[model samples]
Target: MPEYSEKVMEHFKSPKNVGEIAGADGVGEVGNPVCGDMMKFTIKVKDDRLEDVKFLTFGCGAAIAVSSMVAEMAKGMTLDEAMKLTNKDVAKALDGLPGNKMHCSNLGADALHKAIEDYRQKQAS
Candidate 1:
């Protein structure tokens, strides 16, 4: 097994914002079929800011950790700011992820960005 960071373990053990938001302003889901890792992110935006964020993830410890960390980081951020959040930033916030599992960080950010895009699309329509 990979030696995960303490922060990773912490997030996995007790992930924050773990559920979905009913009637959420936006929602996005992504998965790696080969790896069987999946994530769903939901958001509530207000005044051009992400007032709330949540996620449901199924994967390894790293995936769960990334999901939790991303929600926390994106909350209260403007839509543009959240969109700029990269996988590197998510990994750094968790104190870094094992190289073999770095892709989990990518999934986390991708899911969030997709959700943000969904929100924007809905607003524009």
Candidate 2:
């Protein structure tokens, strides 16, 4: 088993922002075939800021914890600021993840980025 940090366990056990936003401004979904982890992030943007963020994750504890961390980190951030978020930042925030599970953080960041991209795309149309 992976040696999980206390923070990771805590978030996994009681993940925050764990639902969907109705009529969300944007939605992003991603999955890893190897680990069979899937994540979906929904965001509400107001005045170019992430007014709210939420996620629905179907995966292991690490993935769930990453999703929660990403949501918390991105909330209230400007679209540009949220876009700058990276997987490494998520891992570091959690105090680190097992090497094998590091990709979970990537999924979290990617999901959030996709959501932002989706919002931008809508604006362009």
lDDT of 1: 0.95
Predicted candidate 1, C-alpha RMSD? 0.8
Give the range where candidate 2 is weakest over 10 consecutive residues by summed lDDT.
31-40
Clashing pairs in 2: none
- TM for candidate 1 is 0.97
Against the true structure, candidate 2 reaches a TM-score of: 0.97
- The C-alpha stretches of model 2 lying farther than 4 A from their native spots are 32-34
Compared with the true structure, what per-residue lDDT tens digits does model 1 show for residues 1-125? 89999999999999999999999999999996577789999999999999999999989999999999999999999999999999999999999998989988999999999999999999999
* Clash count list over all predictions: 0, 0
Model 2 Cα lDDT, one tens digit per residue, 5-119: 9999999999999999999999999996566799999999999999999999999999999999999999999999999999999999999999999988999999999999999
lDDT agreement with native, every candidate: 0.95, 0.96
Clashing pairs in 1: none
Estimate the lDDT of model 2.
0.96
